[model samples]
Target: MTLSFSPSRPAYLGVVRVSAWYDLVVTAGFATPWSYALLHGGLSSVGDALGLGVLPALDPIQTLYANLMGSVVVVWALLRLVRPLAVHGLFDGAARSLFAMWQAYALAHGAMKLLWVFLAVEVGFGLAQLLPWWPSRSNEVEPALQGR
Candidate 1:
């Protein structure tokens, strides 16, 4: 059997939901001061174990920024998790693209290699959600019936 690259709405929405879950799992710790303290230690340990340099000691300003970012992202993720709409995928993909770009910039400016892991995920999900999905035959049938 041949693999099909045709866009499937159900599959696309599934990807959106999966991406949302990933964000929730990864960033939930950053959404609150208490959780971020624990997360900071965990991440620092992982970095040291992987031979990446340890993360710097957490500062109040840094924690504040992290919390703000986490709060926004968690809300966005929840929206996608609840609705899993194609439009949500589009917006999420755009945000992921931006995040990946910033991650790359930080890496270039001496950010830890550990960030590469997050960057890879951001790029993967961004592409999966943002790739063009136009129908091959607009006149043939309704989109819902076209198996798209």
Candidate 2:
């Protein structure tokens, strides 16, 4: 058995780059607590821009929760940029996939309709992270043959 990690293809890497940038701007909205003015507007003049249907009104608790979640997302985004090809990067993408699935499920069940956008974006980013690493028997065996 053998292994190789010569970095992913450029197309996949480009997808990750775009995804990271999107994460930056979107997570900023979550952490800032003042980006809920665009589009249809949020619960307040400035609330969750995504307008979480669950938290239709931004109270103290909602504010605290949003900030906390956003902070974590910021850290994850930084990690994605810093180590895009690292093993943990796969985990990061997988986590986003899960988040997307949850949001899609909620939207389908008539919960948070606003999550529709998230479902699409998350799935796209997740596929970018995951699909590139798919392994082939040739990839596993070719390196060993070349080395020998």
TM-score of each: 0.85, 0.66
lDDT of 2 by residue, 17-51 (tens): 67777887787666755652232254333334445
lDDT for position 81 in model 2: 76
Q: What TM-score number comes out for model 2?
A: 0.66
Model 2 ranges off by over 4 Å: 1-7, 32-55, 86-88, 135-148
In model 2, which residue pairs have backbone atoms overlapping below 3 Å?
none
Predictions: Cα RMSD each: 4.0, 6.2
Top-TM-score structure, candidate number: 1
TM-score of 1: 0.85
- lDDT winner among the candidates? 1
Q: For candidate 1, what is the total of clashing residue pairs?
A: 2
CA lDDT, every model vs. true structure: 0.80, 0.60
